[model samples]
Target: MARMIPDNEAKEILVLYYSQHGATRQMAQLIARGVEQAGLTARLRTVPPVSATCEATAPAIPDSGAPYATHADLEECIGIAVGSPTRFGNMTAAMKYFWDGTSPLWMKHALAGKPAALFTSTGTLHGGQEATLLTMMVPLLHHGMVLVGLPYSEPELTSTQSGGTPYGASHHAGVAGELPISEHERKLCIALGKRLALTARRLNA
Candidate 1:
């Protein structure tokens, strides 16, 4: 079992996500940066990609990027920021699968009342960015997490032609995932991280 720790000592927020083709992963890193900018630790974690064969399984440890997330990470963190690429106006199967395994946490009310945030990446501007974000909120809501979204006061929400939304931070990757993260999208991502970190801090305080 993981060692017990008081909430006062859990001064970090979790930036948990799953990325394919790397766009969502880049956004996750930016969010983690923003979280640190808010003066709290950001615990970066990722879920293993799901495979078709029930016989197939990922190695216990990932070869690179953030480590595979553990339930303890969720239990210890004061807040959470989850991300994933769009999958038909909803979260990817991998992200949904990971959340599905958290029934134990839900039974414990482990995430209730904690601050939560969301982000996503899509292949096209009209590719269900808002829908994915909104749907992503369902599981968090079921966990009784308090959702936080971007407010229009953030100037980029009004100006970004690419990908900044009041729903949450987002990025518009090209069809082949060739386009780089735009300045506006990057700003919104960082802003989200900062906001999530700040909210987690206050909740813990």
Candidate 2:
């Protein structure tokens, strides 16, 4: 069995996500940066892409970016920020798959009362950004997590033509996936992470 992390160890905010074509991954990195800016450690982790073939499997360790998340990561985290690209108005299969397998954590109430946040990226301007963010909250809610969202006070929510929303931070990557994250979107993402971290800290304090 894997050893459990000690409660006395430094607290971490788990930045968990799955990205395809890298847009969502970029957002994840920005959120992690925000988490650190708030003076907490951000443990970046990703879920492996799901393959159609049942027998096919990813290598135990990813070749780059964040390491694959473990149950321990979820259980030991002070808060969580989850992200994924839009998949028909919902989180990607890979992200959903990861949460689906966390029944053990649910059974133990491992995530109950912890603060959680969400983010997403989409290919087009109307491509279900808010829907995906809302749906992403379902699993977190099932885990009994306290939901956190971007409030309108964060000016980006009112001004962004791209993908900043009150539900959570988002990015409009364009249909060709050619566009970079906009300045407003970036600020909202960072703000969301910092907010989540601050909430976790106060709750634990």
Candidate 3:
């Protein structure tokens, strides 16, 4: 465990993400497991995909994986782990759309002082993993959440040749997004999640 689990532990860390090819979604699942490893509950959630046609709509509930997140999830979670598939050196439009609807929480400072972490998956090794992660942090910063990231102290950070960064966890999903996460990349994802959850526990304790 990253830290001693409080006897009265009640708060959870929200593991929210948008995935196109299931790679980012897998990362979110691993992150949530890591959060639970650190003794805090993890709330797995997802955002629906967007469409070019304004008239198109997503179902009220997702068909599989996790349920769609609500503003209440943001308000209730002690911390958050956000993930997205990189899109042209930035976050996906679906993920952005989710944040765009969070103005009400922003106004209430609902996420202020909470800890947040980021994760991303890209089709190639040089597909803007860092840029996507950095840009993803912008809105969380506006919400006044503390940012958490993997440090070099994590052995995988120094040894991993595939995907890992101080900015956040990352995965190389191949051009077709068919690659499974590498061993080192998986460890880093879990590490980042534990780090974020530990921070949340400390602050909330």
Local accuracy by lDDT, each model: 0.89, 0.89, 0.89
Give lDDT tens digits, candidate 2, residues 8-64.
Answer: 789899999988899999999999999999999999999988875422257879998
lDDT of 1 by residue, 76-95 (tens): 88889999999999998888
Segments in model 2 whose C-alpha atoms lie over 4 Å from true places? 1-8, 53-56
TM-score of 3: 0.94
lDDT (tens digit, per residue) of candidate 3 on 50-78: 88653225798977789999998888788
Backbone clashes under 3 angstroms, per model: 0, 0, 0
Residue 190 lDDT in candidate 2? 96
Instruction: Work out the TM-score per prediction.
Output: 0.94, 0.94, 0.94
Q: What does the lDDT come to for candidate 1?
A: 0.89
- Candidate 2: Cα lDDT at 5: 40
In the order shown, what is each candidate's alpha-carbon RMSD? 2.8, 3.0, 3.5
